[model samples]
Target: MRAVIATEPGGPEVLTVAELPDPEAGPGEVVLDVAAAGLNRADLLQRMGFYPPPPGASDVMGMECSGTVAAVGPDVEGWSVGDRACALLAGGGYATKVAVPAGQLMPIPDGVDLVTAAALPEVACTVWSNVFMVAGLQPGEAFLVHGGAGGIGTMAIQLASELGAKVFTTGGTAEKLAACAALGADVTINYRDEDFVEVIREVTDGRGVDVILDNMGAKYLGRNVDTLATEGRLVIIGMQGGTRAELDINALLRKRGAIIATTLRSRPTAEKSAICASVVEHVWPLVAEGLVQPIVHGTMPLAEARAAHALMESGDHMGKILLTT
Candidate 1:
């Protein structure tokens, strides 16, 4: 098997391809012949030594992949060799072969290709778990998302709209916001030009949004609270802008709002599998119907993982960057 390994913590240049032994499925697990892998911010972080793989998990950097089942472990049911699937992984997706718990594997939705299926597991699971499961975005209510053109943002906009939420999002450019709007955002704020808090307030007649999906943690913390309706939920999934911040507890109490911060990769296997199961049952049909398609920015060969990382760092992509085997 061929796998991308980071020899040391540095730039993407440190990533290299090497021959590795094929991984075998353990109890309740399945070995996948990885067809494609999707890039995430965490992949870059792990490559540079900021985030490490979970304890007792694969050392590889990828967190999600789409492929065919090459083998199934003892006691694993509901899946078998040759099943087309995508899976959310604890780690080890950046390879020709990787093993994942069977519960984490989702059958590829009808009409979706193997490579495109790679793009869905992470974004679908992330958006479903955070925006719907945790934050409880409701139909006809205002929903705001930061990083509106990234993979998670693109998926969030579509899924939120499909579920009937009036979506709002912040991007760095007019083109980016336009792309987000095309995906179903009712209000698009250019964070570089407009104050999103003010824009969101003005758009909603000063009442504020009912739910906000944020990736800029510390930087947007104060304003996020300012742009929330009573009982509004703020779900923070990433800290791209910085981590530490000052918050006004009184303001939050006044709004009767709640803030939640979570990461999918760090979750326990059982919880992740549960999220995967629900997404397969509920969201996969949307893909099958073409109502919620994964937006792929580009596909690059797996050996050029550094170039993929460079493209993500440039912030020029409108959706996902995929690495194919």
Candidate 2:
């Protein structure tokens, strides 16, 4: 099988196509004939040597994939060869074939194409688990998402809106913010030109938002606490901004706030499977009903994984970037 490998940690230049042995399904796992794969910010981080795959994970890049089941291992049931499915993985997506736990597999929702299905698992699991499962964003409550035009942000906005939350988001430019608004964001703030904390406070009548989905770690820590309601929750999924910043403990205490940070990729297989199972049961119907759809910015060949990485870094894309095998 041909897959992209990071020869060394650096730029996109480090990515190259290499022929590797095809992975076989282990107990409770399935082997997929890869059709399409999704590119994520974490993919770039892993390529730059800052993020390594968890124990027993593939060295190849790719977090989620949509493909057909080529084979299934022992103890797996309810699926068979040739099932059209998408799956979340720890790694090895940029290839013609990869193996994943059967529990992590999700049947492709009716009416969604294989390529688009590739774009769903990562963002869906990330947003659903963080915003709803962890933060517990409630209907009629204010929800703020940073990087509004991103795959994670776009999904978050739609999911929160579908659940009847008042959604707000921050982007770097007017166009990005507009895109966010079109995706059901009630308030869109240009973080470059406006103070999001102040804007969020003003929009919430000075009470602050009920929940904030953040990727900017240390940089937004203080401001996030400042823009929280009396019992608000801040969920951190990434650290795009610098990871070191001073914290105001008093602010958190005064607001009776909570801060939670996690990465889905590094989780144990059992945990990831549990999350995927929940998504399959609950969120899959939303896609099937056409209430939410995968927002794909572009697709490239698997061999051009480097170019995919370059496009993601440019920050010009509005949604998910995909790589097809």
* Tens digits of lDDT, candidate 1, 1-325: 9999999999989999999899999999999999999999999889889999889988988999999999999999999789999999988888999999998999999999999999999999999999998988888999999998999999999999999999999999889999999999998988888999898878788899999999889999999999999999999988888999999999999999999999999898899999999999889999999999999999998899999999998899989999999
What's the lDDT for candidate 1? 0.93
RMSD, every candidate, angstroms: 0.7, 0.8
Tens digits of per-residue lDDT, candidate 2, 103-169, equal 8899999999987899999999999999988898889999999998999999999989998999989
Q: How much is 163 displaced in model 1, in angstroms?
A: 0.7
TM-score, cand. 1:
0.99
- lDDT, model 1, position 102: 93
Q: Which portions of model 2 show Cα errors greater than 4 Å? A: none
